[model samples]
Target: MRLELLYFFFYSMTVYILETNGWPQQGKHELRWNHSYTGINKPSNPIDKEVLEEFYHSTAGPAWLNNAHWLSGDPCESKWYGVGCNPSGDVVELDLSNNLLAGELPDRLSNMKNLEVLILRHNAISGTISPLLFTMKALRVIDLSYNKLSGSFPPQIELPFLTNLSLSNNQLEGYLPNHWNCLNLEVISISSNMLQGVLPNGLSTLSSLKYFDVSENFFIGPFPKEYSSLTSLETMWLFTNRFNNSIIPESWNKLVKMKNFQADSLAGNLPELIGVNWSDLEVLIVVDGHLTGDIPESFCHLKKLKYLHLFRNSLSGPLPKCFCDLPTSSLVSINLSYNQITGTVPDCFDNFRDLRYFYMENNNLTGTLPRSLSACKHLYTIDVSNNYLVGSIPSLYANLKDTLNWFELDNNRLNEIEDGLEDFIVTLSTKFCSLYGNPWSCPLPNYFSGKEYCTARCSSCNTLEQHSSCEKCLTSTSNCGWCADGRNCLEGYTNGPYYPYHCDQSEWVFGNKTNC
Candidate 1:
């Protein structure tokens, strides 16, 4: 019996050496010999092996892009692809992101009790997430974004160690889970989903939260003012939702660490305290809202601001002159179009060295185009169309010939182009230039005679009966002026009428002169 035992021990030791040293022919023999052996080649706990094999089979193991040694050998002992294990042989991490992983997550994945990270983003995995997966106590990160997962969020989440959870770009619907109590959680993004209902006030307890996004959904009702308690928040996106009649919570001023904040279709004026408190703010977009009131001058204090978009609102009043104090090095884009704001474009742009886009179209602004705008050497778009701006186009605009693409001065009261800018205007018109309603005196290139540019003309203005008042007459068209002597309206340039038709030169009141 001693002789037989010694021979068996020697045989097992030789097989182990050959299998582990890449001797494939001998290793295959060893695998067959130890196919049922559960000592050194299998998981310490039998349940872990069963769970891993089940997950492989349920998720279509053979079809995976990188299914190296899955199911053919011990998961932990043979180093299966994308599988990680703790020293005790428990599965700890499974990162198969963008690995062409398809099919639904097997319910048995919950058996990975020791899993700390599960990243399966950018895959085709579908079906509702199993609630059992959240029961894993050791989970620290879970990113299943860019998948086809649907159904409502899991009802209860009690993970104490989870720090990141992203389910963006999914088809999930229904209200967000309200019972989540992940105290240490820091990032939660469920944007681009169909979730609805008022934001849960319970999220106020997540003091450690830093990033939260729920945009592009059907969520309605007032934003949770309690979320102001998340002072650690750095980014928040709540746009493209149905938060009808909801106003930004005034308490949000307490979130002083904010770097980016965006929302749409909300009601109420922008809170002044946001500019006062959020000194680190970089991007602020609140478009298509019922916002009314002057843009707070305090916004000039946001020295780090880069993008400012407040279009399609009822906001009126002149832009604050203090905007010249805005950080020149950081500002990039500004869009305040489709509002009732009235004032001359601020010539404070000389210091905006990095400015690119400037859009203030469809406003009530009246003034000569500021010569200071030419100081921005990198400007790409300058759209001030549909306003009451008049005067010669600045000759300095020729400096932006190479960078400018979309130059729209259409439907304005502009009359002439400065002498040396013909080439620049020709180049711009070939792009997105619009110089239609203006009555030009200086000759344009023959290019304007083309049918496509027929509206770009120097014709005498036609008289209209709608000029009932001097102010109304000036805005009627570029050439229509009010004659004070006889209270008559006639077509004329700032110097005098083209036909000298019953209007004395001294009695003319047009252009910027309000004395009719």
Candidate 2:
């Protein structure tokens, strides 16, 4: 056999010249392409076919919605559709995400230069981010997120093999590049965009960072206790930024691989050593910030906490009976609303059992209402409204009548309503059951005589009439009753149904009486 057919025709002509010119010391066979070399007739690097025909005539590639096999030839052997080359055909991954790629982003896309994953995300493109595409150092995932990209941030970014960088919701403004050499960054999402200064302690030198989102944007100062050296951070989104009053850096309790931390309008104090070293924290959002004391019984050591939003802060004491030793099947949604928090509400919700949305609204909370939250059975929206809570409403909350929805007890100091929770508050939905300013007990409970149930001060407290003052008959109705001798707005108390007969019953003055 003629020497094995000349060694099988010199190994199929050295694999067709290393797949048509590449690897001859990478001189790419002197940039071939001069006819009859069919590998779909073009691009063995004619500068990647003139930068993919100038990125398909600068991004409008015939109003692309998948301009498949674009420009008709060898964009990586004619399989163009989001071109992804590399077996030495070179162009490596340019996924045209959401392919409606509208214009701008063609500084000849830095002539592809062996791109490594450049996804034009949710494209509608738009101007400004082509410092020659950051001089292509073989990028690793640069997702121009929800594009419409505006200028700034590129006062020198080197990308040393970037690992996931998403330019979030663009219109990007300046500041942010105070030094970060990528160092194999792991997800940096520039959020909402309009970027402002501070927050660059050189990103705590990356250390293989893990998901850092510069939220909402206008970032101001402080929060950088050198980011406690990232230690492989896990999901951090500094929300609605304006870090003017910084604070959260109890040396970030050495991040212990934090899992989801959100910050808004920063000031601080929730750092009781991050609930004993993060313990793989799961979602903690500090809201409308200017946070004050308490809240930290070392957060019952997190045991995988699930969503706790401390709202409108100025936090005060009580509420943390070691949060009933957290880990009640990973509690879901607890918002301490408009905080000024005071005691009560901690009846250790009988092993929460995956509680769902419970907000302590307008806090100043006081006792009564906790039949251990009827063991939560997936409760949905239970707002403890304007608290100062006094007894009555908890007839074991009718075991949340099949996953309750929005049951807010309004302006509290509640008087009564216990027997079988009045058919679960009359099958909720008088705008989701919001019983007004309590003190009930005036022949008024036939499920609160449905004037669409509760509030017109519970059907106008027996038609309030002669109230010459006792603060206008107890401010008109916790069921009236005031008569210090004919100040008469009587509805109850001393068996009132309009009791006056020359008013006396020991000068009546019932329920929350405003001094007579």
TM-score of 1: 0.80
Tell me the tens digit of each residue's lDDT in model 1 across 91-171: 777778778777898888888788888888878899998878789889888888788998777777889999888888789
User: After best superposition, candidate 2 residue 295: deviation in angstroms?
Assistant: 16
Cα lDDT tens digits for candidate 2, 83-117: 76666677767777788888897787787788877
TM-scores, all candidates, are: 0.80, 0.35
Model 2 lDDT vs. the true structure?
A: 0.72
Candidate RMSDs in order: 17.2, 22.4
Off by over 4 Å in 1: 1-49, 446-455, 461-516
Pairs of residues at least 3 apart in sequence or in different chains that clash in candidate 2: none
